[model samples]
Target chain A: MTPLDCVEGKGLACVRGGRTVFRDVGFRLARGEALVVEGPNGSGKTSLLRLVAGLLPAASGTLWVSGGDIVIEEREERGKLIGWLGHHDAVKPQLTAAELLRFFARLQGTRAQSVTAALERVGLSCAADLPCQYLSAGQKKRLALARLKLCGRPLWLLDEPLAALDADGKSLLLTMMREHLATGGLALVATHDPIDLEAARLQLA
Target chain B: MSAFAALLARDIRLAARAGGSAMLALGFFAAVVTLLPLGIGSEARLLASIAAGVLWIAAVLANLLTLDRLFQADYEDGSLDLFALSPLSLEGIAGAKIMAHWLTTGLPLTILSPLLAVLLHLPAAAYPALLVSLLTGTPAISAIGAVATALTVTVRRGGLLLPLIVLPLLTPVVIFGAGTVLASIDGLQNGGIWFLAAFAGVTLPLSPFVAAAALRLNLSE
Candidate 1:
C-alpha cells in the first residue's frame, strides 16, 4: 500500500430506486492499483461502480479521490479524473468508429495522437472506418475499450469489463489494464469472471 | 475541440446525416400546411383569416414531431452515461443539444415557415412578421423541449407523453407566435412580439438548467 490512497470511500450506502443495494461499503485503493469488484447478479456491482464514478448520489457516505473528497470537487473536474465504461457500449450506429473515437477524444480533451494509437491498441485500426452498427459484438466492445484509453484520466470505473470478448480481445483488455496500472492509474473494474491479474478483490455478495 | 462546441457540432451533424430531425419536422410542417387548404375546401378568404393560427399550430406540431428523439438515441446507446460522466455539465450538454436542435429543426422550420405562410394566403406585409416570429419562437420550442427531452429520457415510448407534457407548457409561445403575424395583418399594435421575445428569454436561460436537473434525477432511476 502507498502512503496515500487514490480512491478512499467510507461507509458508502447505495440505493437503486427503492431498494438499498449496499450499505456501509468502503474501500481504499492506491495509484497503479486495480481493484477487481466481484459480485453475482443483482448484487450491486453496477451500482457500486456508478456510485464511485459520481453517476449516482450515494444514500450516505463520502468518496475521496486523490486525497480530496469527490463531493467537494466540482463535477466537471471530478468527471475529468474518472473514465467510466458501462454495459451498453456507447457506439453510435450512424457514426464510423474513427469518427466516434475522434468525437470522444475531442470531448475528453485528449490529444489527437491518442485516437489512432487507442484504436490500434484495441486492434480496431482495420474497423475504424466502419459504421458502428456494422461492427460485430466483439468489435463494439473494442470500440468502448478504445474510448477508455482515449482519455487521460487517472481513474477508471468499468462495469463488467470483460462481458463480450474472445480470447484475443480478453488478452487485449488485460494488456491495456496492465499498461494503465503501470502508469500509476487506478482501475476499479466490475467483473463476474476471474481474470489473471494481481488485483485486490472486493466482493459484494 | 472543446466539449461544448464538439457536442454541438456532432449533434448537428448527426441530425443532418442520420437522425434527420430536419426532414421529419420540415416534412411534417409542410404536410400539415399543405393539407389545410384541401381539408377546408379552398376558401381563400377563410385561409387568409386562419393562416397565422393554422400555420402556427403546424409549426408547434412539427417541432413536437422530433422532440421525443432528442435524447432517445443517446440514452439508448449509453452515450448519456458518457455525457453525464464527462467534464461537461449536464446543463452544458443540454445547451449544446438545444443549439443543435434549433439549427437542424428550428432554424429550418423558421426559414420555411415564411414560404408556407404565403401558401396559406398570408399577406405580403406579414412576411417579415411571420419570419421574425418563427425565428424568435422556435428557440423557445428547443429550450422548453430540452426539458421535455430530459424528462422523457428514461421513458421507453415517450411519443405520447412528450407532446402531452410539452404542448401545455408551450401554449403561450404558440399564442404569442400567431399573435405576432395576426397583429401585423390587422395593422394593429400589440405586445405579441415582446411577449414571444420575453418567453424565449425566460425559456432560453432557464430550461437547460431544469432539463439538466431532470436528467440527473432520471440517472438513478
Candidate 2:
C-alpha cells in the first residue's frame, strides 16, 4: 500500500446536467488533516467529494495525491487512496451483515480478520448475522462505517455520514475518524452539523 | 478471493436468497413455456415445428426479465459508486455481473429447456441441439443486456425501455439459436450452430468494455 501524505487539487470545477456546480476549487490536505466541507443543499458538496474520490470526473482542472516522492494523478491510482461513505449505505438487504462486510473486505483486499474486527469496532458484533434489511437506519449507517474502516485506505470521502446515527453512534463515528486521522490518514467530510475535531474547513457556496 | 470472485459470489448469494432475481426469471421462463402451448392448441407437428422458436423466445424473455435491475440495484443502493472506488476496474465489475447473471439465469434456463421442451413436443432428435444452441447463445444475451442495463441504469423505471433497447439486438441470437435446433430436427447440413457460437464469442469479449464505458458515463453523472 502506498502511504499517501497529501491530496492536492488545482482549479477544480464540476458540472452536472449542463450546470456548473463549483468552479476553480483548490485545496491541499496533508496527512493527519481533516477538511470539513460546508455547503447548502445542491451546492455540490457531494459532487466535490465524489470528484476527489474519482467517482465523478472533474469538469476542469487537475487533482492528485502524493506520498513523499510518489505523486499520483491517474483516476484509478487516486481511487486506491479513498474510502467513500455516500448517502446510501451500500448494503444488500438479503445478505447478513457479516456476509456483507466479508465481501467488501475481499474487494478492498483487506484481511479476513479486519472484517470481524471492524464489525466489533462498529459495535455490530451481535447484529452480524442479521440481514441488512432488518437493520435499523442507525445500524445500517454503522455497517457502512464498518466497511469504511475495513477498506484501510489512507483517505476518506464521507457525505452526510452522521445522518441516521444515534448519539452514541455519532460519537463512535467521531472516534473512528479521530483514530483515522491520528494514524496519518486524511478525511474530507461533507456535513451541515459541526464536527468536534481540529481541522480545516472548506465552505462551498 | 479476488474482487471479481467476491462480487460474483455476493451476487449469486443474493440471487439464492429470498426474492432473488434468478428464481423470478426461472419461474417466468417455465410459466411462459408451459402456458404458450395451452394457447396454441398442441397438434403434435405444429407444436414440434414451433418448439425451437418458442423456447428460444421464452429463454430470451426470461433472460430479459432480470436484466434491467442487474446493475440498477447496485446503482441505487450506492454499491455501484463504491464499486467504482474499489480495486476492481469497471470492466471487471461489468464482467463479474454478466457472469453472475448467466449463472443465475442463462445456465438455469438452459438446464430447464429440455424439461420445458417436452411440453411443446420438441422432437427427441433435437434435444441435444436445443441444449447446445441455448448453452452457446444465452451468454450473448447476458452480455448484451449488461451494456443496455448499464446505459439505462440511472433512468427511473428504465425497465419499461430495456426490452425496446435490448430485444432488437438479441434478434440474431434468437434466429441463430432456433435455426440450429430446427436444422438438427430436419437433419439438415446447416451451420447455424457455428453462427450462434460466433455471435456469442464476439459478444462475450466485447460487451464488458461497452458496458464499462456506459457505467463510467452514468457514474460520473
Candidate 3:
C-alpha cells in the first residue's frame, strides 16, 4: 500500500543569507513509510522541509510529489495532499481548539466535525473550549496534531513535532505516526532528537 | 468557490473571536471624525467644506489599524506556512485575506460613513456618492495594505512600519475617494467615481500577486 510511490527531487541546492545550506540533497517517503530528517540548528532541516512542502524554492533542483511536479503552481491541490506544521505553532491564540480545527478543515474543503472529535483524538477534549492562548505548551502541540485527524492529507511535513511534548504526548504522537503509516500515509519530519519510526533516516550535516 | 469562502470564513471567525476589530475600527473612524471639528473651527461651513476629505482620511486610518495583523498572526502561528504549502495559489490566499480585511474593516467603515458625514455637515446629496465611492475604494486600500503586510511580516516592529509602507501607496485611494465626495458636493458630476472603480478593478487583481510574491520572499528568508 504505497501511498506515495514516486521519487520527488533533483540535485536540489539552497543558498540562504549568502551561505550554502545544502546541495544535491533529496529523499522520498512513500505510503506506510516515513523519513526522519535529523540535523543541528541552522543545518537546513527546516529549509528542506519547506522546500519539499513547496513553501520555498530550491536554489537549484526540482521536486516531484507523488510524481506531480512540485512547483507550488497548484497550491490548493497541494494543500489538500500535504499538511505542514512548522517550528512555530500556527494556531491562532484567540481561537478555541474546536474553532481552530473547524477553520483549517474548512480551508481544506473538508467537512467540519464536532470540535469534540478532533480534540478527543488528540486527548484535548477537556480543553477544547479554552482559547489556544490559555493552553499549556504540550496542549498547544496536541491541538495542532488534532488537525491531522481532521485534515486527512496524505503527506505530513512536520518541523519539530516533538518540540514541547511531554513523555506522554511524545508517545501519543509516535502512535499517531504509526497509525498514519499503517494507513498508507507518508511523512517527512525534521527533528533534533531521534524519532522512533520504522522508516529510513536522512541526516543533514 | 468553497475554498475562497472557507478562507473568508476562517479569517472572520478568528477576527470575531479576537474582539471584533471591525467595530473598533468604525469607532475609531467615528472618533477621528468627531475630533476634527474640535481641532479645527466648529463653523458649519468650514466643517462642510472639508467633510469629505476628513471622512476619507479617517477611513484610511481606520483600515490601517488592522493591517499589521493580517499576515502577522498567521505567520506567527504557522497557518501562513500551511497556507503557503496549500494547493491554493498564494495570490488567491492574498486575495482572500484582502477580502476578509475589507469585510472586517472596510465594510463597517462604509456603513458608518453616513453617521460621520452627518456630524461633518456634508451636503445631503453628497451622502450617496460618498458612500458609493467608499464601497468601491476601500477594497483597493485593503489590497494595497496586503503588499505592505507581506513586506513587513518578518520585521520586529511591523506595526509602526505598516503605515510607512502603506501610506504612500494609499495616496491614490485617498485622491479618488475624496475627489468623488468633493465632486458630489459641488453638484458637478465628475469622473471621480469612475476613477475609483477603475482603481479597485486594477488593484484588486494585481496587488494580491505582489503580496503573494512578497510573502514567498519573507517566508524563504
What is each model's TM-score for chain A? 0.93, 0.97, 0.91
Q: Which 10 residues in a row give candidate 1 chain B its minimum summed lDDT?
A: B12-21
**How high is each candidate's TM-score?**
0.95, 0.98, 0.92
* Model 3: CA > 4 A from native: A1-3, A7-10, A67-79
Weakest 10 consecutive residues, lDDT, candidate 2 chain B?
B183-192
Candidate 1 residue pairs in backbone clash: none
TM-score, candidate 3, first chain: 0.91
Interface RMSD of structure candidate 3 (Å)? 2.2
Residue-level lDDT of model 1, residues A12-74, one tens digit each, is 998776889989889988888999989899989898988887778889998887644333355
Candidate 2 achieves a global lDDT of 0.92
Instruction: Indicate the docking level reached by candidate 3.
Output: medium
lDDT of 2 by residue, A1-205 (tens): 4599889889999999999999999988998999999989999999999889888889999887888788887788778788999999998889999999999889878887877788999899999999889999899999999999888889999999999999999999999999999999999999988878789899889
- Best-to-worst DockQ order: 2, 1, 3
Measured with DockQ on alpha carbons, how good is candidate 1?
0.71
Considering lDDT, where higher is better, how would the candidates rank from best to worst? 2, 1, 3
Give the alpha carbon lDDT tens digit for every residue of B82-167 in model 3.
77655567888998999999998999889889988988889998988898999999999999998998999988789899998899
Model 2 Cα interface RMS deviation (Å): 0.8
Q: Best candidate per lDDT, number?
A: 2
